[model samples]
Target: MNIVHILKKYPVVILLLLLTACEEDGDKIYLSGLEASEFILTETDILLSKENASKIVLSAAWKNNTLVVSNPDMGAPDVFTAYLQISTQEDFSSNVIETEGTGESKAYTGAELNAIARNLGLVPDVATPVYFRLRGSIGANMESAYSGVKTVYISPYLIDMTVGFILDKDKQQTGLTLASPDADGIYTGFVGATSWYNFFMEEGDGKIWGNLAADGSAFLASSEEGSWNFWYPEPGGCYYTEVNTVRKRWSAIYLPALEVSGDITGEMTFDRPNTRWYYVFNAASAGTATIRFSGQGDEYNYETGDGAPAAGKVTIAFAQENGQLVLTGAAGTISVQVPAAGECTLILDLSDPKNWTCEVTSGSEEPEPVAPEVYVIGIDDGITGGGWNFDNKLYLYNEDNLAYAGVLNVHSLWGYQIGTEKDNWGDVYTQAGGDAYSGTLEFKGQNNLAAPAPGVYLFDVSLKNLTYALTAVGDHVYVNGLDDKWEFNQTLAATSVPGVYSGSITVSGASSYGFKIYLVQNNWNMLFGGSDGKLTYGGADIPDSNSWSAGTYTITVDLVNRTYTIQ
Candidate 1:
């Protein structure tokens, strides 16, 4: 290779670099002047218009501190195809108030979408200092026409009008304060989520207000209310079918899958797990009523008329073992398990003699679906002694007491242990090496061990592979997961002193996993520390303080066989 040849190769590389120049491209979407698209808001702004629309306005001040925004057209039945968007400007990236059409918002009809976004005191609706924007599109991909902005308001923050709150379980407060800069800032003339489906809100007294939209106004303010349950989406459009005895016995549940005129079709259902809805009529009842949809757009909606009941109505949302999902508004719960495929259904329809006979009211608010508390033993009912049928739990159980609060578990298994090491039978018993933990394994639900208990206790920590211990005392409890080194089950296997449940021996094993453990005064407090366990009344390390209180105190054994232990 000659030096001249090398120089020629270098020149070729230089030429390539010169031709390759980095280019940049950028485009922005501002709701401004997009076209005459749809406009969605939660309020009509009693401050702006004399009539408080079910939803039409957004306003706030720094005083409100909290950021607030929602779908402009929430709870209206126009089927408007607008999304609740937000930004400092008309652009997409300017700090959004609402995420574009996720979850229920995606398939919401004009009214459904509006109700979701505008529901007062709901999540994603009460936040302040939010920016909002919305646009309308036709067809699934929004390929058709778009709408224009009808009215404009300026604020430090604004939430998209297309976004609204669905008054499901999480936001079921008795009376949530809708923030307002001044009393006038947030006009409640429009009914909040409570009266949204029933009445229109209008400004009445100087301070108080009343429901007014029901009288031929605000989308009929339909007396129709739907129960939140689950069933599969029937292909022939959503309809209400009464459950027969067979269906009730089989625990067959239906979920709903809804398509937002365009975009995506979602299947909706009950919040329970493995739950089924069973509506049974008494044999004496001569008639059966069914809610059917005549056409594709037809829905068994706007429940009206005081209505009449059949002979006997049995509505149940039962768990696998509980009674059928036959609910009559007494006081109970239905456990619905989310299936692996499709959607679930929960509908409330006026049956038989329609005259508003079935007046619907909200049920107990479902707590935010937190991971249920649970307990996991090294033994899984799989191995001979280790396998137990006991289920995971939310709280702890000792003996027979449940409400005592003496529970020492953040997560646990079934409490009622059914079988023995020899038989290895029954559902609650999990086998552990030939020995059974016996007793029902405490099971709350999932991983809700993040709860805190009372009194002072010790914690064990192991990171990477290093082990460390600490003593902590607090009135609250909170746990994330069971880090093997987080805490230990310290209970006495034997006792030297006799206290309240004197002969009670603080047995080893079973304490709050992850975090906090409580000291219930009356119930399991003594039982958990009962029998073989000793309650050392005035000890420095016991659950009872230097002279205790009455509440059931969760006691832990500090030493083993008189061995020198950390007191």
Candidate 2:
């Protein structure tokens, strides 16, 4: 009998038995004899633009395909899956978009079509032929067939190019533009702010960027509204600025030569190795002398800041008080006396903002040159496995005071020692064995220094003072009473520079404004609070009084410098 005729004679029980037998033998019922389907386009030619981004630009539809089982006695599953594929190539070889769905039709919005066209390398504002087809599948892993291809002419739109601007501290436009060629979030351009080092950056879309603190360095930036204006230590003239919206970071590089004028005048020479500026000249008459520092082609008159060099012939110091230069000592006088009218040399060091200073030396005789020596942290005994070694170098914060500071990882009972020499076992500085973190250091102590416990520590030692201190470095720094709640809810994160931490906090208008930086989070025993830009270990509230109003601020703390800034 023919297979069709035999199926007509088979009963329900026999059909069930046949299906069970197929399953037992692990046989798949292949689908065959699929009916041809057609893919139809509602609008073959369409234009996509930003104006119609949300509107449907086109529609595609296909007829439902039908299939029959290869087994004459069995029936095929009625379930079917359809796919809409659009590609630039007629054969769908590359740059193809395939979407699977259960419906017979699909609609493409202007944004959807434009994105597809862009992905397929379609030229903008120009009609391009796009191929479309329908793929239908049935059974398990069975890709039954595909409909004939349909051609569609589509014109896509371009990404909106964005422009950025440079704004002064007062938010006034500076006529400088930062371009985003790729319409990406990053913007870059050179801005000649001249005397105006403090400024802000804004995007065409209303995004704004500024410095995190009022007295923050140029390298630090923030996009948060109401933040302080971007500023450098001194007027750096024109700068190549780059604002990255995606990363929320900005940077600027000053592009100008430095020069000095007034009592001692000359073009400053750049010491690349030392990262400083230097100028040597004879003093016409040194009686309450003043100097002005300016960048090449710069209109700003930047005066000398506080600097005192001990090794110079005549040690001079300068300080910035309310944006002006001043000289003061512990008793509010020039710490280093300026020599009588004679030849002198000036050194400008701006490499480290915390250690920014301008040192001037008098007389033709320069201080005797000495071999540069560095301090390192290591074990006490040289012969021991953990003895003195040239590792873990400390930072020299004050060149005049020979003060070195840095964080060191200490082990309990490790007997640590600070070595002046790099490799030799000479000049081993230490204190009598004890768990104390602060004490006087001996030239060659009989006992090695010991920590209370194993942990990272803040090590500050001054060879000039012959004293050493070790404080356990806390992992976090918290702002307490920022919201007038007397609580620690804001935590400052450690920045790229060690010993520096920064965070944002909001302050509400209150009868009094007070806050403190807690070395230990949520604790008051070890905290910092002070007035002006200086920080005290256990000083008073930050503002010193009720001088600040309600606003959000970025607070940065420099533990090594004992200073803090809120902007």
Estimate the Cα RMSD of every predicted model relative to the unseen true structure.
24.3, 25.4
Per-residue lDDT tens digits of candidate 2, residues 75-131?
656666777888989999888889985565688878668777877888899999999
Question: Which lDDT tens digits does candidate 1 get at residues 202-307?
Answer: 1111111221224222112211233221111112122222211112110111123321111112222222221211121212222222221111212221232111
TM-score of 1: 0.19
Best by TM-score: 2
For model 1, the stretches where C-alpha displacement exceeds 4 angstroms are 1-279, 283-567
Candidate 2: stretches off by over 4 Å: 1-33, 63-79, 160-179, 182-567
Q: TM-score each candidate.
A: 0.19, 0.29
Which 10-residue window of candidate 2 scores lowest in summed lDDT? 13-22
